[model samples]
Structures are given as C-alpha cells and as structure tokens.
Target: MSSAMFARDVPFERSPTTDLPVLLPPRPRERFGWPKLTTRHALLFAALVLVAAGAAFAQAPDAPPAPASEALTTAPATPLSVVVKWAPLLLKGFIFNIVISVAAMTLGTITGLMLGLGQISQNTIVRRLSWFFTQFFRNSPWLVLLFFAMFMIPFQVRIFGTTIPLPDWMKAIVGFALPVMANVSELLRGAIRSIPSGQWEAAESLAFSRTKTIWQIILPQCVKRMLPPWMNLYSLITMATVLASIVGVGEMLTLTAQVHAAEGGRPELFAPLYGFAGLCFFLYCYPISKLTQRLERRYNVKT
Candidate 1:
C-alpha cells in the first residue's frame, strides 16, 4: 500500500484523558479574615494602625537629605552620554576591539583549517605533528602564552642572529593566533568527521579533485555543522580581546580600568564605562548568534 511504503504508522493516540471531578482549594475570601476576634484584639489592631500612621507623620519632617552620590544620579541615560566627555577616546577603544577580533579571526581561520586537515591526514608524521600542536595549545594555559607573547617574544623572535623587525602589536597577534588556530583546526577536524563518509566517496565518484572536494563539498557541509561552535569561538575571541589590554592595548575593559584608576579609585565614576564595554560586546556578538541559530535550523543539526 502507498501508506505502507511512505506513510509512517500512526502509533500515537489522539483521545484525551477523562476529566475527573475537580477538588479545587478554597479561595482566600472563603477563609475567615478576622475569625473570633475578641474586644481586646479589636482594640489592639486599631491601636497598631494608629501608631503606624503617627510614626509616618512624625518621620516626615525629620527625614534625612539624600547623600551627594545618590542625589547626583542622572538616569534615563543615552549610551553616548556615558562617555561624551571623552567620546573620541572611547570610540577609538571600541573600534580597536572590533578590529583586533576580526584580524585574529581571519588569521586564525585560514591556518586552522590547514592544520585541521593535516590533523586528519593519513600520514603518521603529519597526523602526529598536528595532533601534538592542537593538544599543546588546547591543554596549555591561554593566559600564560599571552604574557609570553607580549614579553618574551621580543627576545625569542630573532631570525638568523638578528631580531625580527615586527611591531609589538604584531607580536601580540602572532601570540594570540597560535592557540586559537590550533583550537579552530581541531574543531574543524571534528566537524568534518561528523559528516557521513559517503559524502567523501560521492565527491570522488563525481571525479572532483582533492582540493575541490574539500572546498566545494566537504567544507560547506562541515561549516553548517560547525556554525554553532564557530559562533562560540568568535564570542570567546571577542572577550579574549581583553587579553591585549594587559599588553598595553587600550580596549574597552582596559580603558574602563584606566578611567577608574584615574578618577581617584571611584568605581562609580567609570562603572558604566565597563557597561559600555559589555554593550559593545553585545552589539558585535548578537547578530552572529542569531545567524548561527538560523544556520542550525537550515541544516537541522542538533548542535
């Protein structure tokens, strides 16, 4: 039958459960409000109410003034109003965080894919080497390398007995890039494995070349699967931009700290400065998060 061939057996039941007699609890109005109040109890209730009113009236004239800190608040604030006094610097700091994250992502993705492909390679040496690099970074401390990159890379970056002529920012980039690339590579490799093996065979049967198979077939499928994790990695990197602050780059959080310190240790003065940092992070990240959700729906992937 066509039903047997295509339609699934409707094992599900449709009849609703039989409704039983409802034994609802009584309402508060159904309960006695002032059950069995004696003359003394009635007098006590009235006396307490009068005492409360008299206390409120007595305190009205004696209420203390608001403190300077509480009185100075100007709420219903615009975001620009938070740092309009130093708008140029705050804007520059916000822009730099975005730029650094994009640069790190771009550098990280290209090298990561190559490393990931190598990690899954048939050759023992390539596999072992790739595995070792990925394991080292993934297991090691990110903060440690951050410091080493900013501080020690200067001495160790020499080429052929001469120090490498790269800027501090470049050193920071290189330092930040390695661990991220290693993680990205492993993430890609895992994602690729999750795709059915028949996909690879089908690509080959179509006479697609090795690079074509990877770029055209293998990668896009892998990307859909990897979309959620990729969004997470991007989110992680956006927060990781704060690491550059320790190396002297004045991104949002760093700028907030600097502002806080400059204002005589008054955390209140620049607390919203940190809020602005969080706001920038939200604006930068929320769109990609939404896109990741859409991609997940399109692919019908569980994760």
Candidate 2:
C-alpha cells in the first residue's frame, strides 16, 4: 500500500510534445566605454577630443594673428578689459534706471488706485471717464506716448510766476507711468471682480458703506491677488527702462554704447560689454520674477 501511494504521489514525466512558456533572462544594462563603447559613447568621445584639440590650438604660441583688416572691422577682442574700465559708469547708469523705474511705478500705482475705484463708481460719467482713460493709455503705443510726453508736454510751467522746465528723464518717467497706471488699473479692476458676490453681500449685511466696504474688507483680500501681478508689472517696467535710451535718458545701454565707442569699437569687447549689461538687467529682474511666481502660487492667484 505504501509503495502504491508513493508511485501515485510522484506522478509521471511530461510528454515531449507538451508546450511550455519560455522564460528569457533579463537584459544586461548597456555600458558605454572601453570594451563596450556604444554609438552614443563614440560620438561623445569624438566631440570631447575635438574640443580638447581646439582649446590646445587656441592656447598655442604659434597660432596665427587675425588679419588686420578683419580685426579692424570687427568689435573689440578684449571685452574684459573694456568692461573693467567702464564698469563704474555702467553701474551709475544702472542706478539711474532703477531710480526711474521705482519713481514711475510709485506714481503709477497711486494714480491707478483711484482710476480702478472710479471704474466701479455708481455715477455713469465717472465710470465712462475712467474707462476712456484706461483705454486711451492702454491702446497707445509706448514709444508714441514717450514722444508725446517728450514733445507735446510743455517744458516749462508757470505756477505763481515760477517757471520750471521738465527734464528729458522726467518726461520719460511720466510717459512710462501712464502705461503702468493703465495696466495697474486693469489689474485692480480684475482683482476686485474676482471676489465672490457673497463677499459683497456679507459686507453689505454689516451696514458698511460702499467705500468703507472696499477699503476695509474687499481690498484687504484683493491685496494677495494683486501683489503678484503688481510685482510682475514692475519687472516688465524695469526692463522697459532700456527703451529710455532711445530718448537719450543716459541709462545703462546708452553708457554701454558710449563705452564701446570709446574702446575703439573693438569686436572682442562688443559681446562682453553688452553681455555685462544684459547680466545686470538679468540680476535685477530675475529675483523679482521668481518672487512673483512664488507669491502667485502661494495665493493661488492667476494673472
């Protein structure tokens, strides 16, 4: 009985014709260098060798001088020296750019606050007037506005027998401020509109006047929504200050051009000096952009 049970439990071998799944081994991780160099590795190695050879040739003492005519026609070859010599002046001009942007933005923000509120005024005339102002400034090309402020605005104003002449930089600032005001007004209007009707109803239930409700309750909430856009606008305006050079505002670009010319317009200096100017703008604007993005995300505001 024990021998019979063992034979039954052991079972029989499978028939040769029976089909079974084939189990393949996992693929070996493809390697790159030496004995196992792949197409990708070959290409990368070739590129690296070419770069090394080029660098060695460049540093070699026997390297030939550039043709005199080519050298003369091109920008300065030594940009670092030029930048070193002119850095102070460029920095001064950059400071002016900063000052102008800040002043224009400040003025624009104050004016925009009033214009935005006026757009929602109970009186039809006030609303229309605000809309007209916003559209006029918004639709006008910035260059044209700059030209108008530079030329059409009277240079001298007589107040109590006192005559004052507006400087070119001041006119540029005012020109820039108009567009900023229009944009900020739109931002404010949108932020206010974004609040739920429930908020307005709640304020009204508290017996608050419209102005009081806006100032005390509504605007406080809108601040979070408005701040990110406000910072974004400032960055744009900061970059736009470069345009002031067209009107001879003596800003960084203007100084760069002057320095480049002073440096004999050498081809080598062209990239370095201009690149330095661009770097300055980048350094100034990049942080603002990052901050704006962070604030927008934190407040869950889209603009």
Worst 10 residues of 1 by lDDT: 28-37
**Residue 39 in model 1: shift from native, Å?**
52
lDDT of 1 by residue, 17-136 (tens): 653333335445322122344798578656754554454345333326777687567332332354565556766788877777778778878888889999888899999998998888
Q: Could you give the C-alpha RMSD of every candidate to the true structure, in order shown?
A: 15.8, 16.9
Q: Pick the candidate with the highest TM-score.
A: 2
Colliding pairs, model 1:
none
How many clashing pairs per prediction, in order?
0, 9
Candidate 1, superposed: residue stretches over 4 Å from native: 1-82, 155-164, 204-212
Stretch of 10 with least lDDT, candidate 2: 29-38
Candidate 2, pairs of clashing residues = 74-267, 75-266, 75-267, 75-268, 76-266, 76-267, 76-268, 76-269, 77-268
